[model samples]
Target: MDAVQGLETGDTFILHATFKPVPLFAVMKAKGFTYESEQLDKKHWKVTFVKRGLGQ
Candidate 1:
């Protein structure tokens, strides 16, 4: 969460995890971010979060 606090509008952060982080989607959305999730393989998933502009 600390990492997210540093994001500026239009900044993107990519997260890699062992499992699909479904819960985090809602959290990011509430913080004005849009995300895309991709499963790389059986054991890895990648989620990209982009901070949106005001009113976006």
Candidate 2:
């Protein structure tokens, strides 16, 4: 799973630590977000899921 972007523990993120809600980082990985695993650390990931629609 991916990590949260601009993660500041608070203020910048919603900080969802609940079983009902999946971790933001996990959500990112599930969305197919990738990175240079060879160079990147396990703590640096911020994948987001944008809903696709006909129009904004």
Candidate 3:
């Protein structure tokens, strides 16, 4: 969350977690970010959050 604080439009923040952060997706979306998630292994996941520009 701190990583996203200074994001400009179109900027991206990547997060690594032990499990899929499903709830966070909605929170970020509400803040104008879109996300993509990938499972790295049995216990690791990577989520990338991108801030959308206006009219996107």
Candidate 4:
């Protein structure tokens, strides 16, 4: 979660993982980030998150 800690307003992060990161998604969503996710293959997923304004 280092990415989350370093995020600033209007920053975006993209991550690729071997499995769907449901727990990570939950934490980021709860922290007021907006995101989209897509499955790229049987064993890969991509998730993008944007950090908006504070308390968003």
Tens-place lDDT digits, model 4, residues 1-56: 77688888889999999999988877888877888999999999999999879666
Clashes of each: 0, 1, 0, 0
lDDT of 2 at 34: 27
lDDT for each residue of candidate 3 in 1-56, tens digit (9 for 90 to 100)? 67788999989899999999999999999989999999999999999999999888
The TM-score that candidate 2 achieves is 0.22
lDDT of 2 by residue, 1-56 (tens): 22444333221222222232334445544544322212133444332333322332
Candidate 2: residue 19 Cα off by (Å): 18
Worst lDDT 10-window in candidate 4? 1-10
Could you arrange the candidates by TM-score from highest to lowest?
1, 3, 4, 2
Stretches > 4 Å off in candidate 2 = 1-22, 35-56
Superposed by TM-score, candidate 2 places the C-alpha of residue 53 at a distance from the truth, in angstroms, of 21
Residue 49, model 3: Cα distance from true site in angstroms:
0.6
Better of 3 and 4 by lDDT: 3
Clashing pairs in 2: 3-45
Global lDDT of each candidate: 0.97, 0.33, 0.93, 0.88
Arrange candidates, best lDDT first. Answer: 1, 3, 4, 2
Q: How much lDDT does candidate 3 score?
A: 0.93
